[model samples]
Target: MSEWLQLPFVQNALLGGLLAGILCGIMGTYVVANRIAYLAGGIAHAAYGGVGLALFFGLSPLLGVLGFTLAGALIMGWLYLRERHRADTAIGVLWAFGMAVGVLFTDLTPGYNVDLMSYLFGSILAISRGSLAAMAALIVAIGLFVICFYRDLAAVSYDDEFARARGIPVTALQLLLIVSVALSVVVLIRVVGLILVIALLTIAPYMAEKRCRSLASMMVMSSLLNCLFAVVGLGLSIRFNVTSGPAIICVASLAYFAFMGWLALRRRA
Candidate 1:
């Protein structure tokens, strides 16, 4: 492990994994609490449109994706709040558009040289300094927002009607949460990609929810669990020469099954 740590690519992979775990762990609590797990993948897939746009225009993919994701979040959030029935249709539309635009742009680009495998699966070891910096900043921002709005979010999460009656800006807060999911997807895509992001976001939170008594504790434990998966997955990938993202997801899945088995034993006892 020490020798591997000395390698620059390994170091970047570890750091990238850490950031992904932390960001997903925190925001994932909100996603699970609200029963909006499905929203994450949609927003993530839609961000591919941004990536495509950026690639087409020779701009930074991160910046382009961020802009596109924010737009998708707003549209989804508003649809969800105003007409829950209509949101799925819009999500479907955005999902298709995102993928279509990405493919179209990539095709049109002359000598379009990009790593689709890395985007689709993951490329943690290839993380650049700028990506790391952006991820850290976004994670910090998310942590602060979650901390500041703990009480309000608690109300909204557990009882939306009660929160609304208490004069909480449910619409605004919901939009903010959805946007945060977008930011999380951006960070997580490097570790797991849009295709597998929901697993990374939800698996830890689900396990954490089983033992935690409050939302706050769930976030903390989920973050820890995510960190565990990231580290273990990186180790497994290194040892076996496997893909990092899927390796992590497999670890998370194993842990989930283990937790479920323990619960069953306890119930039988």
Candidate 2:
């Protein structure tokens, strides 16, 4: 353990894990409360478009991903509000379209993008200092958003009809929620990858929902749980010489299932 922490890569992975855990906990609460788990896949996969664009244009992948995801999130949120198309259907389309765009752009790039897998499956050990800073900034922004709009968000999340009656900007807040979800997805992309992002985003929050009475409490508990998962998963990966993202998700899955089994037994007893 001591030896593992001594390595720079391990240290970076830990830092990335901690930061991702915090953001996921915060955002996951909203995702579950809003019943928008599907949105995670849409935003994450759509982000791949940005990554491919960045690689092709020789720009920052982070910027490209963020821009593309925000656009996708906005579209998803808007589509959810309309009467004609179902939100899930829209999400499905965007999910496939985004990834397809990424692949197309990557193909058009000067050379085959060898590092595409890193974004797809994550590269936590390779987290850069700039990535850490970006994560910190996003976390801060989310914290502030929650602090400033707690009442409105809570009202909208739990009861949009009631919130609108109370003069809350329900539509705007809904859009904001999706955009924030996009940011949260970005925070985890480097650590967990697009494919596994939903697991990281939802697992801790799902488990915490059973134990917590309030959304705020759920966020706190979920954050702690996510941190534990990240730490334990990272340890397992280091020992087994495997990929960290899937390892972390595996640990989380075990814990989630264990908790469910315990709940079932408790109810029976």
Candidate 3:
């Protein structure tokens, strides 16, 4: 373990985990408060198209993924605002379309040989310093946004009507939330892959919510849980020569089940 920690790549993975943990905690909370798990999934799978585009254009895949997902998020937010009745349907359409675009574009790329598994399950050790910087920037941006609009976001998340009565720009805030989710999704994809990203964005907060009395407390607890899972998972991956992303996510799932079992046993007692 000590020897593994000495490796540069291992250090990068640890840093990535720390950054990812923070982003996941914040975005996960937003997803829960807004009740947008599926919407988050939409944004994540949609970012695959951006990955394909990036590969085709010789650009940074992460940047491409963020751009494409953000665009999709904005469009989805607009449609939802315009017709709340059809928000789910609109998200479904975009979700399927974004996934198809990514797959189709990847297939069309000439002589492009990329490992699909890395994007699906994550290769945290493969994360570069540049990616870490991007993740750090995202965390800072999200922190700033949260600090600036905590109250309005709280009201909007819990009750849009009340938020509006209080003069909150519900539409703009929703847009911002969607964009934030997109950014988080981009960073998370590198940690847990698109297939399992939503779980990371959701499970920690869900667990923390069971014990926390306030949203602020929930966020703090979730961040701590996320960090623990990331560190333990990364350590296990290093010890066993397994993949870091899945290891991290599996740790989270274990924590989820453990908490549930404990709760059930306590209820029985």
Candidate 4:
């Protein structure tokens, strides 16, 4: 294990996982607080269109996904804001549409044999230094955004009506949150894939929410929990020769269930 950690690819994978964990931890707090998991999922799945776009255009897949997901996020954000009650139906439609677009473009990319599973399930061990740098930049951007607007974000997350009454721009903040989630989803696609990205984003934050008293504390604890899950999952994957993305999510899911079970037993007792 120690020797394996020294390998450049392994090191990149570890760093990538940690960066992804932190990014997810912060944005995920708002995601769970805002009850926008479905919205995030839509953005994530929609990102596949970007993958196919990149492939078809012979551009970097990450760049393609980044641009495509942001566009999808804006569209979904508007739909959500415009029709809050019926947003789910629209989001679901866009979600499938985005995926279908990806598949169509991928097929149209003549003579290109794309590894579809990598985008859908992740390819963490194959992550490069460039991807790591991109992930780090996103973390810095998101960190600054959170620091500057923590109070307003907290107000909006918990109660938009009160936030609006207090003169906070609830609608704008909600849109920004959606955009941030899209960025986070783009970075995490390599860590946990589009399908499992929501699990990594929501599970740790969801667990932390139950134990923390404040949004700030929840973010802090959630980051730590996500980091732990990433590290443990990566280690287990290496040890058992399993797929890293699924391994990480499995660990997180187990922890979530275990924590809930403990709470249930305590309540009964």
Candidate 5:
């Protein structure tokens, strides 16, 4: 394992995993607290359209994901705000449409026989330094956003009606939260892939939520837990010659169940 850490690719994977974990931890707190996991999942799957578009047009796939996901986030955010009760129907539509668009574009691309599994299941070991820079920038941006609007976001998350009564611009904050989820999805897709991104996003935060009394504490603990999972999973993958993404999720899943069982036992006691 020490020898693996000496490799440049391994180092990059570690850094990427940490960055991804932090990003997911912060954004995922809101995702879980606000019950927007389904919405976040929609944004994630919808990002595949960006992948296909980028492939067809010979553009950077990450850029394509960013563009498509932001657009989807905005559309979904609006639909959620305007038709809260019927939002799921619209989210499902966008989710399916985005994936369909991706598949169509990939089919149309001439001689583009790239492995789709990498995008679907992630290739964390193959992450580039450029992607790392983008992830860092996003973390900084999101960190600043959270610092600036911590109280309002917290208020909105726990009680939007009360937040609105206090003149907290609940609608705008909600839209920003949705957009933030989209950006977080972009960061995580490279680490966990779109299909598994939601699990990484929610798992640590979900676990932390049960233990922490405050959202800020939950975010901090979740970030630490995500980083731990990444390290353990990466190590396990190296040891067993398994896929890194699934290995990471497996670690998180096991921990989640263990924690749940502990809580259940304590309640029985």
Candidate 6:
């Protein structure tokens, strides 16, 4: 591991994994608490539009993805407030539309020979210093924001009506949660890609929640699980020459299912 850290790309990948793990843990807790996994996945796939636009404009793909997904998140959050029952319908529509538009834009862009695979499966080796810096900043900002409003968020996450009864501005907090979720999705796109991003966001937290009592404990356990999976997966990828993103996610899935199986056995016994 020490020798691995000596390589610049390895260092970048490690940093990227750390940031991605933090984002996943924090945002994922909100997702679980709010039952918004499908919604978050919709936002992630919708970010493909931003990626395609970035290719067309010769700009940073991450920025474009962030903007597009943030817009989609806001729209979904607003719709959920007015029509909770139809929110899933709205997400499905945007998810398909965004991906379709992205494909069209990528096809139309001249001399744009970008491989869609990296974006789909992630390429942490492609993580640059600038992107890493931006990711770090976003992670810090997200951490700070969550810390400042954790109580309100926890209340709203557990019971929106109760939060409202307590004058917690549940609506605004929900919006903020979704927005943060969208941003976290963007940050994770680099490490897990758009395709498996949802899994990375959900799996560790899901498993951690099983062993943890509070959201804070879940975050800590999730982060530790994420880091372990990331590092071990990256090492395995290096040895096997496989894709890191899917490798990490696969490990997470194994851990998640294994825990579930154990829980089931315990219940039966």
Give one clash count per candidate, in the order shown.
0, 0, 0, 0, 0, 0
Stretches of candidate 1 exceeding 4 Å from the true structure = none
Off by over 4 Å in 4: none
Candidate lDDT values, in order: 0.83, 0.86, 0.84, 0.90, 0.89, 0.83
- For model 6, residues 1-269, the per-residue Cα lDDT tens digits are 57877999988887787777777877887787678888888888888888888888877887788889899889878887777787888889998998887888899899887677877888987788877877778788989988999989899998888999998999988998889888877876766687667876788888887778888998888878888888877888876888888888788888888989999999999
Question: Per-residue lDDT for 4-46 in model 1, tens only?
Answer: 8899989988888888888888888988888777677678888
- Candidate 5, 1-269: lDDT as tens digits: 79999999999989988888899889889999998888888899899899889999999987898999999989988998887888999999999999899889999999987667877778889988988998899999999999999999999999999999999999999999999899888877866687657877899999999989999999999999999998898889988999998889899999999999999999999
Off by over 4 Å in 3: 81-86
The candidate with the higher TM-score, 2 or 4, is: 4
How many clashing residue pairs, candidate 6?
0
Q: Which prediction has the highest lDDT against the true structure? A: 4
List the candidates' TM-scores in order.
0.93, 0.95, 0.93, 0.96, 0.96, 0.94
Q: How well does model 1 score by local distance difference test?
A: 0.83
lDDT rank, highest first? Answer: 4, 5, 2, 3, 1, 6
User: C-alpha displacement of 86 in model 5, angstroms?
Assistant: 2.5
Worst 10 contiguous positions by lDDT, candidate 3: 190-199
lDDT (10s digit) by residue, model 3, range 202-245: 99988987898767787888888888998999999888988877
Count of backbone collisions in candidate 3: 0
lDDT of 3 at 101: 79
Q: Cα lDDT for residue 150, model 3?
A: 89
